[model samples]
Target: MIRRSRWVACAGPFLFPWGEAGSRRVYGLVASLAAAGYDVVVAGGGPEPLTTTALPGIDGPGSVSHIGLSEKPPPDAGPLASSIQTLLRWGQRTVRWLDAQPTRPSHVLVHGGQAQYMFHLQRWCRRNRVPLIVDVVDWFNGRHVRGGYLGPLHASMKLALHHYYPRCDGIIAISSYLENHYRRTDKPILRVPPTLDVKNLTVDARQTVDDSSPLRLVYAGNPHGNRKDLLGTVIEAVGHIQREGASVELRVYGPTLDDVRHLFDGRPLPDGVRCLGRLPQAQVAGALQEADFSVLVRRPERAADAGFSTKFCESLASGTPVIANLTSDMGRYLRPNLEGLVCRDHSLAEVTEAFRTAARLSGAQRSLMRQAARSQALESFDYRAYAEPLGSFFRNWD
Candidate 1:
């Protein structure tokens, strides 16, 4: 399977290889697409000036040419000047690949960035006869910045602009909600939830859960940006069970202790809850692999449906079942008594009951679930699983 096609991606708002959740998704996409044989190039917004780097490849057999695009403006640059500068960067870097490279890009996939930049990119792709695919991952309506009076209005406008799909040729949705939101459109849609490297997926690190040791639960992600509102509820539920003498421990993995403390309004965390603070990805993976379950129980809301939980897939990758509720298209993938357990909802009563359910599971039963989780990761979340499908999907655009 050889492909001469080149696919360039715009890594909006995220720095390649090092940014948060969105960056990892872009990395996975690049890896999968490259394995599919396309020459994948990623242009990411960074605080620094536009330049190429010697970063190692996540793109399996191939290497990704990473060009850092400065998202930050010069201190004295006006908005108009900044926008013009950005347009020039795109035109010079992505659009003019034909001048310096042997082949023009067949597709331009946007993870997202500034609205002005996206609008221009869309128009150019249309004029140049290139397919423009928007990766619709999140739709949180909160104001993205701390701007003064116009913050709300600006945020709303940005949010709305991202959802305006009339100009887009295709969509790579992170959830069913996002995919279906644009289902009426004539554009092609591909639902790709949080995916990771699965080549070395091994559940052997997780052994039988012992009744003597605590039933460990891990949560890894932004504490507030994603409205990890249910984290407090999870803490309380675990506290309640601990009071009842259940052996359990909840681990918080993303935010620093100070940040977590501030988010909880200076309130104390419940017993059996440990704020491990922002940890290295390796440590987070180690914790997840050792845990009985990873947690992602958000309340049912539009924000919840707008995107999938990357941590949920991470849990599966670590062979850890999740104590989660259905949001996005998560319910479809979770098997209640198998790879993962889903809560009916994210309320206190339901969350408490979910904890009890885990408490009741025997060591062997939990081991079976862990094995199921590893299988699920290998079957569904592996980058390789999407390589052929994405190849076929992009090939059809021609």
Candidate 2:
């Protein structure tokens, strides 16, 4: 029997195998590490049961432990308070759990957390002489907070980041924007973006475009306050395209029709627009494979600059091109007319023109673009490619 290395991954409070992009990234990392012959224990807080079926591709599901810290808090608690309390409890339980293990972990990997709890974890790791690698997935500053009521909380969190990030043993950034922002003394900073299990994503060889068939466009994600304006802009742009006599159909998943209506202030949906409620991963993958293009946009803000979109990677892996605005490090990977169309200003006219350009592409051109999209995924976003680098990094800590 092969002796496997053990690792403990501390992620935020989320049900395993959920639709949230950050949770999916954590799952992918755990599964990849397990596949690479590491015994990974995912510790977090959630009510959902974590079963073998929840982790489909992982080997020895019994070896991978799921340690739940506490039940999710009710909605009455403010967002900042809830996050702080959850991380506090999770950090406490995680330290106790580590003490009970027969052997200490080779290293500890923390995905995201509150500043105080993360600092506490850092101190514990230092005392135990264990390597602690922090993954920076988002800017934890005030940009994510919607109203001005949480200004003080956001400011304190920002202060925490200033003190917390520089003390970690190593840092893993998800985008160039974050890489540039969090460059403290010469610690090992790896740019590991959102990764996809490319082997599982079945690529369609058949062309999605048919001159006679209406252009099929798909968008899947939640409509948070930060994302609402961009989503509304896309919807209005779709309406413009339809009115110009373009046979385009936009199918939106992850938000109900009523939700979208509410975003539009109860305005009726235009023709060729359909809102399908949240879907399972398998169904969303199928929709992407069958669509001509996927649409994504982010406004110019600190929050937008700090992270990359996982939907963009999924779309490309499904052999579908994208129509996205240039934000963060997205331009580094996607090129206009090669992988997909890009909107420069994200203005209504620019987005509408992008849709028109995509609609005008010939069948052969679209097929090549789809191939390029898949190639990009295989080259840059595959999770298997990350395993070796991450494993080597942990091993060298000794």
Candidate 3:
């Protein structure tokens, strides 16, 4: 009998049952690691805490377990206070949980970029002679700076990044831009971009494209203030296409109908445009499958450029071609006219033209594009393959 290597993952206070992009990424990595014969324990959940649920669809291979924290942060607490409380609580619970284990984890994977818990975890790892790895999933500093809500908290987190991250044993970056930003001369760094479980997410048989049906385009994600530019661009482009008398419809999920109306400056949605509101992950997958194309347009800001959208992979996994702007590492992954269309600019005219190009494709051509999308997903973005790099890194670490 072989003793499986044990690992612990700590993602402070943000765990979910499913549907969230970030949580899904973490779950995918952990599940893949378990599938590869590691004994894995994921410590997560706060605020709205999670109950002990079976790791989604994971069974009969390697061992995987979840330890959900029941302590919830106060709703009235400020951002810094809430984060600090959550971190402190998680650290305490983690230490107790570790003490109960027969042996300490070989490595500790910290998911978030900046956390007070990381400092505590680092000290713990140091005392135990265990490797501590930080996965920088997004540019948290850029987001805080752009968001303008937590000034002092952002300053402290920036300091923490410079101070604690360098001391970590390894770093996992989600994009090339992030890898460059967090590069440390003494630490081992791996660029593992966001990936999806293509095998599970993809449709078994490609659906036949009906030429007579309207050219359906779908966009799903929060339409928050920072994301206004992309959502606005897509809305205007859809309006432009409608004015041209094109048989097209842009269905948007994630944002409420009232929010979508507000985004269009209180005016009515353009012809053939509908706000479908938020949908479950399964429903979003269904929407992607039913659509001819999916849209993701982001401005070339530092925050946007440093992070790759998980939706890009999810869209392709659903066998729907993407119409995305050249932001982040999207251009590096998506080949124009192969997996999807990449817009050179984020202007309405450019996105509108891209839509027109996709709309113009014949049924056979569209089917080919869908096949290309799924092929690209399986080739590059499969979660199992995505986990191999990190697995090797973990195993090779002395």
**Residue-pair clashes per candidate:** 0, 0, 0
lDDT tens digits, residue span 57-171, model 2: 4443224556665534656879777766654553665577666667778778876655655766787789888888877777764545633437744654565567777678888
lDDT of 1 by residue, 149-191 (tens): 3664355346434554545888888888878877878788888
All models: lDDT?
A: 0.71, 0.73, 0.73
Runs of candidate 1 with Cα error greater than 4 angstroms are 1-5, 10-13, 47-62, 73-102, 143-164, 201-206, 262-265
Return the TM-score for candidate 3, rounded to 2 decimals: 0.89
As for lDDT, the candidate ahead, 1 or 3, is 3
Whichever of 1 and 2 has more lDDT, that candidate is: 2
Q: Identify the runs in model 2 with alpha carbons over 4 angstroms from their true place.
A: 1-6, 47-64, 74-84, 87-90, 141-143, 146-156, 226-229
TM-score of 2: 0.88
Error of 3 at 105 (Å): 0.8
Q: What C-alpha root-mean-square deviation, in Å, does candidate 3 show against the real structure?
A: 3.2
lDDT of 3 by residue, 1-398 (tens): 11344655544445555567767777767766666556666676553333343554443365655666543365777978766665455466655655566667877887753556666677788888888888777665345454354665475456556777767888878888878877744688888877656777748485577777788899988857435347877888888877887889888888888888877888878888888878988788788987888998877887777777888888888898899887788877689888889888888889999988887888887888899989888877776775556667778663
